[model samples]
Target: MTGKMLRGMVITLVLAGGLAACANDPSITDTIDTRSAPDGMKTVGVCYNGNNTTRAAVSEIALKACPKGTTKLKLWDKDHMANACPLTKVNRVVFLCLH
Candidate 1:
């Protein structure tokens, strides 16, 4: 292949990879755990890429996880750890669904 062709291929591949890394708006990239806490409160485990995620987006994830019209969310826990969020570095936020 010519040098020009090779460079074009490389650029295309790079662009494709970059696009793949971008999360669709409001996309949830972490595990969604809706388990009952000891007090019977509902909880969800969610994470986001701190570099690109927004508070509203994260809130939307939690809202969608809970049963609509039945519960409100309360932040229960938060931390940063490796492998917590997919497609990006770690940042986790847990919310409790309160009745």
Candidate 2:
């Protein structure tokens, strides 16, 4: 392929990759924000990139709900009472499913 064509392809690929990354994160946040589990329910976030979950669920829950991808599901953990959920009270469980 010509040099110009190659450069164009590379630029397009880079732009696509960046957009994809952006897309993934926000979706998870949105999901978490708008989620509400049943009364006295706890949820665990399933990591999209790895097997283990994150410990930031506590901080995340504290923040105001926005979207699914905003908080990231894997970062959360199951609990009898929403212990670490940023909110003062967690009456139910809502999974922060992250991509």
Candidate 3:
């Protein structure tokens, strides 16, 4: 290929990669519902913009919602098709807190 064409392709690739790298940078919303389950258990709903959100970020947010005496969190359900959240959050992750 010509030098000009190669340069153009390189520039395009760089820009695309930059945009893709930012896919996981969107804000996430955590909704905690204690009444959803019985005592000693709680449900956490996470709303995210993209599917690229890191697992660590999601786990951190859920753990923060745990009660004062919570020992660990048991993942009761994780439903991607559950559109309980609005905005750009297409997936719904439900974590059940255990004390």
Tens digits of per-residue lDDT, candidate 1, 12-80, equal: 999988876664333434434433455766667666777776888888878888766645778877766
Q: Candidates 2 and 3: which is better by lDDT? A: 3
- Which residue pairs collide, candidate 1? none
lDDT of each: 0.67, 0.41, 0.64
Stronger candidate by TM-score (1 vs 2)? 1
TM-score between candidate 1 and the true structure: 0.64
Q: What ranking emerges by TM-score with the best candidate at the front?
A: 1, 3, 2
Minimum summed lDDT over a 10-residue window in model 2 is located at: 45-54
Which stretch of 10 consecutive residues in model 1 shows the poorest summed lDDT? 26-35
Q: Which stretches of candidate 3 lie over 4 Å from their true place?
A: 1-40
| Residue-level error in angstroms, candidate 2, position 74 | 14
Q: Give the lDDT of residue 10 in candidate 1.
A: 100
Badly placed stretches (over 4 Å) of model 2 are 26-62, 66-99
Shift of residue 71 alpha carbon in model 3, Å: 2.8
